[model samples]
Target: MHINALKSLVMDAVDELKGQDVVTLDVSRLTSVTDLMLVVSGTSSRHVAALADNVVEKAKQQGIKPLGVEGRTGSEWVLVDLGDLVVHLMQVETRQTYDLERLWSDFPSDIHEVRHGEQA
Candidate 1:
């Protein structure tokens, strides 16, 4: 699938899981590590885990397998690596503390603000 399509799929999955603060960063120019960076927030540890699981399952259904997953056991900050894409699911507090947005401020990204009642 195309990179943007894959990105939309991932975002859809995150939306299905009711993830908050979902943002998609176009890191193609900033780094060679990945084409895109998806950042999402979960209400708590369990919520984060659940969101990650949902994303994994959704990706599988779409025929995209994650290369690996990290931080699942603790669920503080789960990172799903999909080679071309990297997804980060974390608790609000953890996300705030890590401040990934600030960390990767140089990268050009499209910020999609998810309103509470809007469709994901």
Candidate 2:
């Protein structure tokens, strides 16, 4: 699927689920496998799992299947790979621990703090 279309679908799913600190980073220049990385924090483990599942279901509904899913065991952090778009659904603790956002800080990441606004 087109990057923008996939982005829209993922954003909608996360927003509908009330995912917090939703952010999208363009990692095309730094990563070889994927072009975009979307990160969001769920209120709890169950919420994290549901958020990931929602994204998967919505993508499948739109004829887009995930390449793979990870971290469903404890549901602390779930990573969904959709070829060009990789999504990270994490609990607040997990998100802070990994800090993927800070890891890719050199890039001009368009942090979607307001659902539709630029980085803060």
Candidate 3:
């Protein structure tokens, strides 16, 4: 799937499940690992897991298979890797603890805070 379309699909899925504090980082110029990174927060462990599942399901519906999924066992944070996009679904506390936004934003890049699937 195209990057933008995949981004929309992922964002929509997160919005559908009410993922909190959605943030999209354009890392294409910063890294070759993936073009974009989406960091989302969930209310709890279950919410985090569900968000990851939803992203995977939505991608599959569009014929996009994820490269990998991690952190489902604990559910505090779940990551869905979709080649061009990598999604981080984490519990609020975990998100604060790791502070991915600050970590990645340290470098020069476009950081967009997304709310309800729209840039905030």
Better candidate by TM-score, 1 or 2: 2
Candidate 3 lDDT tens digits, 1-66: 788899889989999999988888777888899988899999989899999999999999999999
What are the lDDT scores of the predictions, listed in order? 0.83, 0.87, 0.89
Which pairs of residues clash in candidate 2, taking residues 3 or more apart in a chain or in different chains?
none
- What is the lDDT, from 0 to 100, of the residue 59 in candidate 3? 94
lDDT string for model 2 (24-109, tens) is 87777776998888889999999999999999999999999899999999999999999999999999999999888887874565
- Rank candidates by lDDT, best first: 3, 2, 1
TM for every model, in the order presented, reads: 0.85, 0.89, 0.90
Tens digit per residue, CA lDDT, model 1, 1-120: 788788778888888878998876666667789877888999989999998998899889988889999999999899999888899999999999998877787445543333334554
Error of 2 at 9 (Å): 0.3
- Residue-pair clash count for candidate 3: 0
